[model samples]
Target: MKKIKPLFLLLILNTISYAQGCSDAGICSVGNSFSNEIQESKNGIELGSIFGKGEADVISISSYITYTRNFSERFSLSGKVTYSQASGEFGTRGQFGDAYAIGNYKFKKMTNKQWSSLFGFKFPFSSANLKINGYPIPLDYQASLGTFDAIVGITFNYKKWDFNSALQLPIINNNKNSYFKEYSGTDDFPSTNLFERKPDVLFRSNYTLKTTNQKFTFRPNLLFIYHLGEDSYKNIFGNRERISGSEGLTINGNLITSYSINSKSSIELSLATPFVVRTIRPDGLTRSITAGFTYKRSF
Candidate 1:
């Protein structure tokens, strides 16, 4: 156990280093909108619903409400709520929800510009309950986890075409440990008393291109997520050693089209897919597709 401590620390450090260097890393960003827990569309006052599907018998349903209000033309406040449910055949089913509030301050404003810079802090709160099958021998149990994250990011926007890029980082995170570990027969699960607080790092980029007549917009995005501390998972039924990790990565792509009718309201349709790039096997190789619509009434 003492020797394993060094190895575990090394893994955690490596994950953080890689997350910080994602821009230079060769990992290709997937192209798609609606693939993210947080919507990439940077607009004021939007509401939408999302439905996602994937191979391996997976399904997800979600709804979102977002509002952005500008202050003094250079500062803005944005908030969003996402409620989602995900279920898979490989002994996984759960419901998760996230709520975030961000403050944006524009540094440079360019008229008809192709690029701009905005800085902001994101406060993300998440909660989930998951269950695994073939566990505890014929009985299933619920496991829950919750987290609070403090994040910051900078965004670059283009005007001639609807395109944007962003990079975000989490400076602080508060996670619940009891929700992640399971009990063992001989060795009791570590008490939550020893849990430690840690931060996560994430990188994201998004771009939008409009076709002729501006009837359709193509949006693509990439996100790389890395957790910096140990998280534990157990198979109580198997009576084996628990699995623990401090790092993982996910890649996603999406395409969406918006059709305008009058002026105040438009209809949007989207398809999104996400893949786990690097992580523990079985739990890492997962994919999903989401199709949804947006209806807006301008005030």
Candidate 2:
């Protein structure tokens, strides 16, 4: 019985290390970029599932409150907090909570315009807690991974068609420390350092089509991720090892259909899938699917 606590903590740590980048529950940076166009009044919620290639599967739910205020004709700011949880078979379960604040400055903008450019920065802070029971013993642990990112992008809007391309660079990387503690008691156990702040770069492109009524929209996006620094990947199952570099290509297509219940209220549903590229396979090649909905209102 005394051994159960340590084992549980280890399981939690393991789940977080491998599952961080794979889950779809967190606030997607790209999604926030378009917040200005979304009718602002109430918050939104998205519930989805994450399917891994093998034994790893996750069901996730995320929600956010978006506020968009335009200070000038070309400047706007949006802030939101997103929470998500992932649970699967084999006693694998994890939760991620994130808060993001982003400011967008538009270079050129017109209603139903075909071209626009925006410079922005996204400061996202996140915390994760994981737990697994199937291990020889129960394991539970928590970690905080946070980073500040700068973004520059160009958007093209053609009637009902919208296209966006963007690049993101991490300006400040926050290294998080992981510690082990007894699951039941206030005892401190050996600590393990899981991840360090390393430079990260991301490129993404998206295309969206608006319905005739402009209430429904369909968006498909391609995201490419590259790690620019020598960051180490360690887990409860092994010793500290450094990953030379990492790259991932993900294609996510989401169908968001919105119904204007009234002038101030709307509901939306989104479905998305991420296909894995060989260059970015961490444990191995993987694939995932995410689907959810959101309810929004305008003040």
Candidate 3:
């Protein structure tokens, strides 16, 4: 294809639908994104793709289609949809992932520093229950989290640096998964049956370096994602059990480079890796490393 897209909105850390499947799912890359930008038109679209290695060396891939409508200099809205897949020891699976819609409002004041508020939501196509051989697969294998989540975030810019923070709250969890430890192939990755995920709070900081002509840009980013509480799942007895140690933080380091093909279009490459990790990630948001590309245009 000619292009691909980016977002929890990322594990936008794993880097939107992780920067297509990057962020926690698509949270970090919505609305007025946290990355460096050279806005050339009021309406725009992007195609992005992500390739990653997750737990147990599962090879994962995702693609996205994104559209943005800029109402003015201070406001904009964006919609992104994604499809994801993976191949591990078990088998290969692919499907549409989540959909996100976000609105952003930039503060009118603060000339030296621009402040923007972000709000959005995630809609899943599957219930985190992708199955094979009559059994539910691990989260890393499924394309969607099967949860409806609300997202709110803020972005602040000072010169070449941008700071962003976001919260993703699960308004409804419809995950009907049944991948238990018993289904494991002699390895104990946690059971995700009836997985009940907690809220996530994420922070990101990045610095942008651009050439004198502003045609090429380089960015280094750091992301921190914290699980608000321990996740839970129903056991065989139907008892809700908390997955201990599920409440913690994951840290990722990201690097990005972009090329401006013209005034109305551009191309970007992003890379991310986990520098710090949690012991147990049952939410299916785990990734060891990620790489992706985005082609953007303003019209």
Best by lDDT: 3
Tens digits of lDDT, candidate 1, 1-299: 35434533543343333222121111121111212112233355667775544333455555667776555445566666665555544344543345556665554456644333344443333322233452321001111123444444444455423343343443443422322233423221232321233344555565555656765555444555555555344333433232444345555444445675545556776544444543432222223334567765444
| Candidate 3 error regions (>4 Å) | 1-24, 35-40
Of candidate 3, the 10-residue stretch with the lowest lDDT total is 1-10
lDDT values for all models: 0.41, 0.44, 0.77
TM-score leader: 3
lDDT of 2 at 193: 42
- Give the clashing residue pairs of candidate 2, or none: 8-138, 8-139, 8-140, 9-139, 9-140, 41-297
Candidate achieving higher lDDT, 1 or 3: 3
**Per-residue lDDT of model 3, residues 1-299, tens digit only:** 01112321233444523321235466555623643343547899999988877777788888999998888777788899999988887789999999998887878646558778888889999998988777678888888888999999888889878899999899999999898877576453688889988888888888777777989877777888887899998888888999998898887777777899988898998777676777777776676667789998989
User: Each model's TM-score, in the order given?
Assistant: 0.56, 0.61, 0.89
- lDDT string, candidate 2, 1-299, tens digits: 24434533443343333323332212244444543363343333322222332223433334456665656655666665554444444333444444555565555656666455556554444432233452311111221244565666666665545556555565665534443323323332222245443443445555555556766555544555444545454455657655443343444333344567777676765444444432433222233433345665545
Off by over 4 Å in 1: 1-43, 54-56, 87-96, 111-145, 158-206, 221-230, 233-249, 274-276, 281-285
RMSD of each: 12.5, 11.8, 5.9
* Model 2 lDDT at residue 252: 38
